[model samples]
Target: MATAYISTPLGSAKLEGDENGLNTVTVLEQDEPESKIIPDVLIDAAYQLNEYFEGKRQNFDLLLNPEGTEFQKKVWSLLSEIPYGKTLSYLELSRRLGDVKAIRAVASANGKNPLWIIIPCHRVIGSDGSLTGYAGGLHRKKWLLNHESPSRQQSLF
Candidate 1:
């Protein structure tokens, strides 16, 4: 798999994929020295991600191939349909999957989402309107949500 790293507001993001499709986009602790130069395969993913971070793009259009179980794939598929700037509770996501009893499983798959902002697992939240779990840390999650919010903070004099 070809890998490319880009510095994001949250941290350094590692983009992994190849001819099959873009696989994963995970945040790192800090900006690390990139090992490989951006490959031809990863250019679009990098550009789209850069646009996303800049708030100039809200959606992504690229081939994706996230490795996961059948059930996990189903959960991730549904996650991609979630509109930008909108939040879905874990319980609601479970219900959408046709089994509220599977809340825990759904949340677990959401947590394991590999595509990061592209698939938008950060859009998932606690049922109690709280920022719950995130692989990239809660602070980053908050920043992402705020970034997508239509209610941009405007300075009025």
Candidate 2:
């Protein structure tokens, strides 16, 4: 597999992938050195993620290969459909998955999402509209959501 480290406003991200597709894109709490030579797939992912953080890109267009159970994969897929700047509650996500009673299970899957920002798992919130669990920590999650908020936060030129 090939890999690359991308710098972002909130933190740096580790992008990993291979010929098959992009695998994981994780935000690192600590610093990591960017690879001098990055794979083509990882290169594209890193570029897209950079654009996303800059508000220059709204959607990702990369082949993804996030490893997970069938249920988790399904949950992650739905997360990808949540439009940019929009948020969904775990209960709502569970309903979309055709099992409202699986709210906790859906949240569990969201917690395990491997693609990070690309999968948009950060958009999922508590049923009460409160920011809840995020593997990347609540601060980063709030920053990302605010960055993507559609209600124009006044452009910086």
Candidate 3:
């Protein structure tokens, strides 16, 4: 698989993929000298991601092959259904999956999502509308939510 470092508003990210499809998009604190070469698949992903960050693209159009178990795949699939500028609680996600008892499992799978914003995992929040666990950090999660919301903006003062 080929890989390359991609810089984003959240931070630097490592994108990996091949002709089969994009495999992973991981956040990195520093650039790794040994990172794989950027392949065409990943290049397209990066361009799409740039458009997403700039609010020009609401939906992605790239091949994705996130690795996970069947149950995790199911959870990720449900997460993708969450519309832009909206949020879902872990309990709600569990219920949607037709297994309320899987709340914890659902949250676990959410944390393990490899696609980040592309998979829309950040749309999941606490039941009381509070921000919750996000692998990329809560601040980034808040930033993402705000970015998707039309009413949010930084104050000049």
Top of the candidates by lDDT:
1
Provide the global lDDT of candidate 3 against the true structure: 0.86
How close to the true structure is residue 138 of candidate 2, measured as C-alpha lDDT?
A: 91
lDDT string for model 1 (72-142, tens) is 99999999989998989999999999999999999899999999899999889988889998999988888
Overlapping backbone residue pairs in candidate 1 total 0
Please give the RMSD to the true structure for each candidate, in Å: 2.9, 2.8, 2.9
> Each prediction's TM-score against the native?
0.94, 0.94, 0.91
Q: Give a tens-digit lDDT track for model 2, residues 1-157.
A: 8878877887778888898899898889997876777777787888888788778999999999989999999999999999998899998999999999999899899999989899999999988889999999999888888888876675211
Alpha-carbon shift of residue 35 in model 3 (angstroms): 9.1
Off by over 4 Å in 2: 152-157
Instruction: Give lDDT tens digits, candidate 3, residues 35-147.
Output: 34556668888888889988898888888899999999999999999998889999999999999999999999999999878899999999988899999988888889988
Error of 1 at 111 (Å): 0.9
